[model samples]
Target: MKAGYVIRDQERPHFITITVVDWIDIFTRKNYREIISNCFRFCIKNKGMILYGYVIMSNHIHLIVQSRDGKLSDLIRDFKKFTANQILAALHNEPESRREWILERFAKATETHTRNKNFQVWQYGNHAEEIFSLKFMWNKLNYIHLNPVRSGIVEKAIHYIDSSARNYADEKGVLDITLAENPVTDTRKNSEFWKYNSYED
Candidate 1:
């Protein structure tokens, strides 16, 4: 992992990106995307994950998350391990046209690493950036929401059903997320900061 991408403050919310090995577009399948959503639901319910924002793309996922129990790293590790196994199983048992090709890619990805035995689904290291301030938090939130829009998957961010953009728009999303609240006070300095840095999607 790179020095800057390391998670320093486990209790603070961080913007994280987890990518597929070789950037393969495995999540273009609905079943695979549902697996990701189910994992988030499990983590939030049982593992003390406080999910603020999330978006699942074709090959990667973006999230703004913190740990209620101060074990964010552990939570992430378990998530990846379980999700990888489930995805591999799905590729084998489910009806997939490119199952062999995708499995071959995953198998090839593990050739460089001893930790992975049969396959490697996710790439190593989450590019994590700690949310240092309210401005930074909202900036990451907008970035997460706008990812599908930038990819041309949807005209508006909220139209993407796999993202927390729907929750932010006051609609029920596939998974529950804790709505991030503005902590900024009405001081002159903070007012100026918000005026200059307020993010809009």
Candidate 2:
């Protein structure tokens, strides 16, 4: 497991990339995709975090986000917890027989997580890498947008229905959203230098 996300160069906001437990492909189905999308939509609507660019790989998700109105860790924890429960319930009650096989996979990956009653839908580490410079964010954004292309699944970034690539490319997503400003620059990203106000240590 990755070490807990540290405030690397805490002078700016961070870009976090988290993977599924044991690289389980929980999102092979559309119902799973909807669950993840709902979590993103909820975070944006509630003004808890700024949803930037993202790409959904088979087993992981990448996000460029910054905390607002509260701690970033809490926001992510809530998101993971909610999605895990909802997705798990869907596996149980949603009459999708294919889900039985998926549940078996999830169970296998979560064996270690189930110890001490932990619901191990997702891996524990929320891999956060702070993004302080524009150049770095630029690269990360392009990396995110081009993930599908890199995988040879599609020739274009917007072709993937599971990503924010369409929104960033100025097309509306099925879920609907205004484009997240490209190059992902903002006061939030630069607020780290003065985070002393919110710092306790």
Candidate 3:
């Protein structure tokens, strides 16, 4: 939890990365991915979370998000707590071949921290980076969308079903997201418009 990565402004959108404990590939399964999607939907509908972009990878997820009620920290805390319990319960109830292994890892992760009662699912601290400018916002959005492609999971970003890239491409994604405007195009236009209109003495 570095000071730079902490979420300072609750109302501003921030790019966040939430990783699984020990970088476990728990989200390779559809059920696990669905759990994440459902949690996001719940937050959006009930927790004042304004999700702008997201992508769920095998071991982690990236999101560009804000809080409508200016309580982003609380929303993130609740999301992590609820999702961790649901995922742990699913591992116990579902037919997972790697159940024992995964559970052992989660349990081991909690050994260093007394706060965890039994297991720790997610790695602490979301590595939150606030989106300061329009260019930075678009940069983060593109990064989130292209993560799967960069990881060799999909050829095109839109082909990834677990990402908001599809939504940006005019296709339905797993969960709804607030589509961010393309600031690069707008910036270019603005620059061109003001190129020759500067006041000179």
Top-TM-score candidate index: 3
RMSD to the true structure for each prediction, in A, is 4.3, 9.8, 7.3
Alpha-carbon shift of residue 80 in model 1 (angstroms): 0.5
TM-score of 1: 0.90
Task: Give per-residue lDDT, candidate 3, residue 201.
Answer: 23
Instruction: Report the C-alpha lDDT of model 2 over 73-138, residue by residue, as the tens digit.
Output: 677777888888898898888777666666676677756544425346777777788776766775
lDDT of 3 by residue, 9-57 (tens): 9899999999999999999999999999999999999988999899999
lDDT, residue 118, model 1: 89
Residue 44 Cα positional deviation in candidate 3, in Å, after optimal superposition:
0.8
Candidates sorted by lDDT, descending order? 1, 3, 2
lDDT of every predicted structure (CA atoms)? 0.87, 0.69, 0.87
Best-to-worst order by TM-score is: 3, 1, 2
Q: List the residue pairs that clash in candidate 3.
A: none
TM-score of 3: 0.91
RMSD of 1: 4.3
lDDT by residue for model 1 over 91-139, one digit each (tens)?
A: 9999999999999999999898799998999999999999998788877
* Residue range with the least summed lDDT across 10 consecutive positions in model 2: 191-200
Ranked by TM-score, the better of candidates 1 and 3 is 3
